[model samples]
Target: MFTGIIEAMGTLTELRRQGEDVVLTVEAPGLDFSDVKLGDSIATNGVCLTVIALGDKRYSADVSLETLARTGFAQAKVGDRMNLEKALTPSSRLGGHLVSGHVDGMGQVMSRRSSGRAIEYWIKAPADLSRYIAEKGSIAVDGISLTVNAVKGDAFLLTIVPHTAEETTIARWKPGHRVNLEVDQIARYLERLLQGGAGAQAPSSTLTLAKLAQSGFL
Candidate 1:
């Protein structure tokens, strides 16, 4: 698990096809890549990847065919920047919203503009994923936790502070660029609860509010 706060920006060092899979290499920034071990999970642009090898200041992970197809990761060229985040420990403070580091779908950057002292961006998301987005709701974009400033059909907008733009890859985004997105964990839980009738009496059980009050269980 992770809090979608980006720790650093990593540059793509190499990407090579190895039979049916692709190996992705990234140059870590300001972070100690020495401690990164094999099988350690790291978020690369909101996509959870297991470290397969560690270099001087770079690390490598193998990307499956599914990842390449679903994430538009195959389009990542050398030197492209990616938002990087280490997995959270039990003692780590969750400065951002809960993130599974699992990219649900790809969203394209529609526009990036200056909004006073902040930077505002618009992204076009998949039609199905649009329902999960709400104004002021938490959303993880490329591993950076942000609040939705507004929603417009299949697209949404968010504001980025200067610090965020400098520390992460938001500043590098432009029209047609793709980003990973993850919805709020609480909303997913709510959906499951409502769908499964969590904590609610089954139909035909006659467990109405008045009945519960009379039963001293209200």
Candidate 2:
């Protein structure tokens, strides 16, 4: 699991295609590599990639076709900057919401505008995932945890302060840019519980406007 808090910015040094998979070499000198090991997991742009090779402030991970199909990595290139975050440790602070490093879907930046010292962006998420988003809800966009200031249809709003823009890759984002999106884990679990757990169909709702009126709720 990850905290969705970006620790540092990393650059993709190399993208070597091997068969159907691609290997990524990321260089992040600013990140602490002392505790990182070959098998450790790192959240690269919100995707959980296992470290396969380790070096001096650099590491390599193999990206499978499944990940490529679901993430923005399908269009990633060398020299592209990415938000990086190490896996959560037992003693680590939960600075952000729980992130599985699993990209639920890809969202596109719909618009951007300036708000005082911050930049406000509207991102259009997938239609299927819209139900999971709520105003003031937490979301992880490209591995950086942020709050949803508002929601409209399938799009949501994010206000990025100067510190967030400087610390991560949000500054590089623009309209039409694709970003990895991971909704709050709690929302997903609640949905499953509402559906009556695994393998159970969603319970049908019998309440309606007429029932509300009968109960004096209207």
Which prediction has the highest lDDT against the true structure?
A: 2
lDDT of candidate 2 over 1-218, digit per residue (tens): 99988999999999999999999999999999999998999999999999999988999999999999999999999999989999999999999899999999999999999999999999999999999999999999999899999999999999999999999999999999999999988878766654555576657655555765798744
Candidate 1 lDDT, 1-218, residue by residue in tens? 98998888889989999998999999986766655788999999998999988878788999998888778587888988888888988888999988998778899999989999899999999998898898889999988999999999999999999999889888888899888888887777655544556677645434455764697733
Candidate 1 wrongly placed segments (more than 4 Å)? 197-218
Q: Where is model 2 more than 4 Å wrong at Cα?
A: 198-218
Error of 1 at 27 (Å): 1.1
Backbone N/Cα/C clashes per model = 0, 0
